[model samples]
Target: MKTFQTVRGKLSGQILLWVLLAMSTTVYGQQSPITISGTITESGSGMPVAGASVFIENTSFGAVSDFDGNYSLNAQLENKDYTLIASYLGFTTQRITISITGDDLEKDIVLAEDLLSLDEVVVTGTGTGANRRSLGNAVASVKSKDLTNNGATQVDQAIAGKVSGALVQQNSGDPAGGISIRLRGASTISGSSDPLYIVDGIIISNSSNELIDLGGNSQNRLADLNPNDIDKIEIIKGAAAAAIYGSRASNGVVQIFTKKGKSGEPKFTFMTNVRLNELRKKIDYNTVPLAWEVATDRNNLATVEVERYDLQDAIFDTGFGLENYFSVNGGNEKTSYFLSASHLDNEGIVQNTDFKRYGFKANLTQKAFDWLDITGGFNYVRSISNDVPNGGINSAYGAITGFLFSDNSIDPTPDESGVYPVTSPLVARTNPMEAVDRFDFNQKTNRVITSIA
Candidate 1:
């Protein structure tokens, strides 16, 4: 009887212990894990900023803002102070400390843009970035945002009219025509007047090296660089700013920096553009207000009369162009990568003249340690340019002004054999329109560039 009574007492004691433990567990479970929710916005604009990280200080608990900049996080802690940190690229990080009361809380945060972004770093003699404040001479810098706002298909064209004390002129309207940039006026009397070009700490030539004849128009090798891939441009107009480069930099200097990879989640972008160019007006001579005779029908004066015709309408066509670009970027704390591809198709104001280009670029960066870093870049491009006979004083072969002296009575149309009929086959000057089809000037090139550091 005593054993049975002891067993019952012990069982009752065990049940009481279990009940107390269950009660304690329930209270502990409800003690913390407070829900916090809010929106992250720009300080002055109050605009939501997506993709910003909202994390608890000294803990892994965090959340990323949604498309609308809304975020929610559940954190467990006692009634004590906890720090919350929010961070994003190109913006100042923000922190907030609050005491948790084991209840839901709503807090909105406003972050301001970092103002130091305006002062760009320049490459110095020691291969390191020098602060803008330390430079003795004035240096003009342009960033990617500015390039995007302006249409710069070619790198040289990117700075056209944007820089001070600089002259950027296209040799001709031909697609392959070169762009000449002269800073601080004439540096020399004869030898190449182009400024020295540097890309990523490496000296590159921007000469118009002509391998093929496209109406004798030389192409600037700088055009091979895709403006979409550039991150920044610095023009050293003052002599003090270019003293490090020496006599090669006598004309001045132009430094181009390519875009690099950033650490973050994978991001994708796609863009397209269409351009059209129409001739607003043309120059032509009036019909003289009286009948003009050609040698062919001078015998019959009454029957042979002048007929007015618009030559420009028959020679030129509407020019249109199309462009497409795609890019992908992403990275972790250790490694990052950027990839891009683009294509362009441009038509000239004159018929049968056009240009096309294709480009691809890739860049990668890896941080092996705090002091050791590695970077690599690769690029490939292909282009095609077609042109017709243009320029000069020749009346028979000139594309622009050769048609000036042709009589209005003569019809400059092709016959059934696809041949332009001239006023007279035996005359010194043939129809200028026939020269357009007979002459051909086209060029094609493919090149690759790579670098590592």
Candidate 2:
């Protein structure tokens, strides 16, 4: 009987030990942490996308991807039904629903680019990227295709009426006429009100005084840039949008981005255009008889009959323009190059006025390392202008003063007297033809601009 009791007590202790062991096992299972690991990649290229964020839906548990686009998260998941979300900028968000148990789980997600979404950002203000929908400022972007389609000569002219809130005005009818650009109306009380121009990360000085003093009284400096070489243009209107550019941008800012070579098979492009330009409008001058009668009345002299002259008919003519361009681009994955040459000849509607330019450009880009890129480009342009004397005394304006309102018909050629025979009230005024043949005004300019990045 004593032996039986001892065995029974031993069995009771063993059963109690077993019950405690089962309870401890159940509690451990409920508190264990599960690890979730995964990798993220681009759907199309299958390239790993680092810096992606992965998190459980509606929870504070999350992890960030490492350099290899791998992530690991630890969580004490209570429910089997839970969702994992992975997101990154410029890519579509990915979500996966799965059951969680007391075990490690592995997941791999592939994301695609969000092309249709306007949320894709662009750099508008200096070094700042903003969504297109949230911007309050007036900005317009013109692609390379637009400039080519319009056959625009200058960058500013390419964006003319197409963009809202920006005004482009042509000051003259000449082929080389000046253009005026205004952003949200004139803001300054006095001084130049033109916008600032930035080309290829270089801020160019657009001093109005300089334009007046050195540019032969041109309206803006944007005419210095050729449209064919431009890759894109961004116009920032109003002070608020251009504040970062400082005082130079008081009017506004126009940023120009030039084209560079692309890596691919060797490519060649050639284009030529032959354009004809005629006088769009003519200014009517007073008849010779009418002019002489008016002059006699003003001078209170006896009736003097004057010969008539068609001064307008003799000064203007139909002009022609010809342009030619050729380019060659070829490169490998490590290096690329682009070279272009262009020639332009344009004649003015007015006699003895013309413009010619020869330009060449070369751009090279090299990938020195995975994260380092180097680019260098240069442009050389030489222009010649054959200009007529149009202003000042004894100039084109003077010829108009003498011929149209003269007291007598004047012949443009010299008579046997070796003196310009005048039929007008003034004898000091020379014939328009004689002045044009004797006066020759010509100017030549050569410019070289280069950039390194």
lDDT of each: 0.74, 0.69
Top candidate (TM-score): 1
Candidate 2 C-alpha lDDT tens digits along 1-453: 999999999999999999999998887667648899989887657789999999999878899999898999999776477878888888757666768877888999877564322244545545656665565556777777888777666667787877788888875444555677888688777877788887776777543232122113232445456678887777777566655778878788887888777555567888887777777776665554633345436776545565666665555678788888888876754787988898888887766667777889999988787555698989887866665444334332333444444433566666697676553445455455554455465656666778888
Model 2: per-residue Cα lDDT at residue 438: 55
Candidate 1 Cα outliers beyond 4 Å, as residue runs: 1-120, 131-134, 211-216, 289-305, 393-398, 401-410, 415-432
Residue-level lDDT tens digits of model 1 in 201-312 = 6788776555544333567888778888888888877777557788788778898888777655677888898878567678765565345344466675644356766666
Q: TM-score for all predictions?
A: 0.67, 0.65
Cα displacement (angstroms), candidate 2, residue 397, comes to 5.3
